[model samples]
Target: MTSKRRATSVTGNIGESVLPLVAKQHLGAINPLDILPLNASSTAKSPDFRVRLHPQFPAAFRNVTGLTPNIAFNYWPAESKAVDTRGNANGSVDRAIQQLGAYWFGRHSFEPNVVGYGLVCCFIYRGTRINPLQEINFHVVAPASMSAQTSLLRRVRHHAANGGRNDFLDELKTDGSQSRRQLLDV
Candidate 1:
């Protein structure tokens, strides 16, 4: 298979493997009826799988309440021409940002305070130039939360012409080690 296809296949296996584990661990916390394969159809944007919280979930999970879905995921293989290649992240990272952003919106809607928590998880990669993004390399899980603890508006709005802009993208273009480390810690 082509590298891209191989990468996708491997990633699929990983995702397939995780769903049951998550379902088992979450038990009452996750909505089994709606969680798996949330809107996988090609007509619109959706997560590879979503973590739909139970309706009775605690208020600690809530924020302002605009009503966005809770945590969701978008899967990308860690292999070559996928999430990373030759030890450097590739365009797939960009796609994750976009997709995860969309999922957060779909979960959050117009209300910034949705009284529910949401997070993004990325499968980390360790690779070499020879094997590129192949799974033969190590893979780690990194988490990022869009919960109220981190202001989504502020994070995305930093790019505004407002003098206070954090040069967010620039920081990313430069050495993103600090920001990346922050995500890993999440």
Candidate 2:
């Protein structure tokens, strides 16, 4: 018999594959921004998706890389117990926040893009098939000085205040026990 950890890994992998496609399709319906997954290789550090600024952004928001996000995206199914494989003790949320903030800065400082705006959306779910996402938390991560890198997740005040309990990133034992066929239905 497969171990629980092994089973859980499989379920997480299934969710990892399916969620992005479902999200892109669902969220991209009104698609203001370019909805693109960050590629599987990037999952270790960066957020799952990249919602870049709309091409019309310049015309609408004065065509400048300013307060509005030149780049944005969601961190899907941010499991509370998630730990970074990079030897960091922090969970998935913290890791995503840091990587994204750094990416935002790289875009901001660079001339071709010269982006000064970004959004960090964190989703933690006790969610079921009927509600695949619950307590979806989104915060517009503003442009700060380069030195502000480490403070990424903390910048989202409510999340910081809430810690990893009850509010922001609630602990969830995801469908680790669910069969692969069952997970696919969701």
Candidate 3:
């Protein structure tokens, strides 16, 4: 059977064609942060990420690059587990934090069109580059255009913090496991 997981590598230029395609193909009606699978109390519905295009960002940008203007999503997970991957080595915690911080810098530095397309795609590329075994990929289908009604930057930062914590923990867990295997073999 094919692995339940999928992997993809995509590269696109900054231009108009990419914008609409990204919107139509990726950003449809879904919120950016809401990309995670939704589960909640009996009455509570699975939430969605609130995503929007920047109003002042100019429709002209659409024409300038001939691509969809850059789009981003806000995300939060209801629960997470912190696994220690740092093995039994000293400075593991510090190393994990440093790696995660570097990952975030790599993510935020991506320029629209110059980098990959949507947030998820860019993340997968970064993840694979940083950790070869742990590759992630997902896509959302929604067509509604949204307004950047609230503090977009703040929301993005919040999501980044939450996601980064999990990444740091996961890295430590991976490192610990690899170390264990090595010790067992020796």
Candidate 4:
């Protein structure tokens, strides 16, 4: 398989294996029925998972309107070396964000019951003696508002204008490292 396909397969396997544990350990109780696969046929781009309310779920899980809000999850795999640098990691994050943004902005005849979305990126370090699974570190990216989209676009434009170099993602890389450490500590 191509490198891209291999990476995707690894990412999918990790998502399938880890997401349930993550939800249970981090987000309190979650029923199996609450998780669904995104509909790939309808959207050019889609998240890996869609989380909604289960019929028998507790009242505490419901929103103010007493309805379950949908959450989108996307999985990504990254090389530790690539993510160590702002420029290298920027490409990966930008691509993921662009794809997610497309889903956010695209017109759909049938609207999905989604409220927010997140990207889960797993970074594997090079030449590590430990198992790749153990070495993998995860980071999540959730844009707070449409302003993030505009900011990303501005960065893209700036990069293009400056012959494709920008430090816009410098802080993001640091934030990812801190987030990963925090998650592992939990």
The lDDT for every candidate, in the order shown, is: 0.36, 0.34, 0.29, 0.36
Per-residue CA lDDT of candidate 4, range 44-153, in tens?
Answer: 54455544422222243343223332333222211111232233444555454434434433321133222123434433323232322233333443333344334544
lDDT of 2 by residue, 1-186 (tens): 111233344545332443344334533423534555555343334445555443423332332223333333332211112221212222444444445433433333332232223334444434334444334343343334322322333333334355522222221112232111111110
Q: Candidate 1 — which residues are off by over 4 angstroms? A: 1-17, 26-31, 34-36, 40-45, 53-97, 114-117, 120-150, 154-185
**RMSD (Å) per prediction:** 9.6, 14.2, 19.1, 10.9
Better TM-score candidate (1, 3): 1
Q: Write the per-residue lDDT of candidate 1 for residues 109-165, one digit (tens) a residue.
A: 344343122323333244544554434222221334454325444443443435322
Check candidate 4 and list the clashing pairs. Answer: none
After superposition of all CA atoms, the RMSD between model 1 and the true structure is 9.6
At residue 124, candidate 4 shows an lDDT of 35
Q: Quick one: ranking by TM-score, best first?
A: 4, 1, 2, 3
Model 3 C-alpha lDDT per residue in residues 1-186, reported as the tens digit of each score:
112233355343222122233443543424443334334345332222212433312354344334453344332111111212212222422332233223332344352111111222111112232343322222221111222212222333444577843443344235443211211100
- Model 3 off-target regions past 4 Å? 1-106, 109-153, 159-186
Q: How well does model 3 score by local distance difference test?
A: 0.29
Candidate 2 regions exceeding 4 Å error are 1-33, 40-44, 53-92, 105-116, 127-133, 144-186
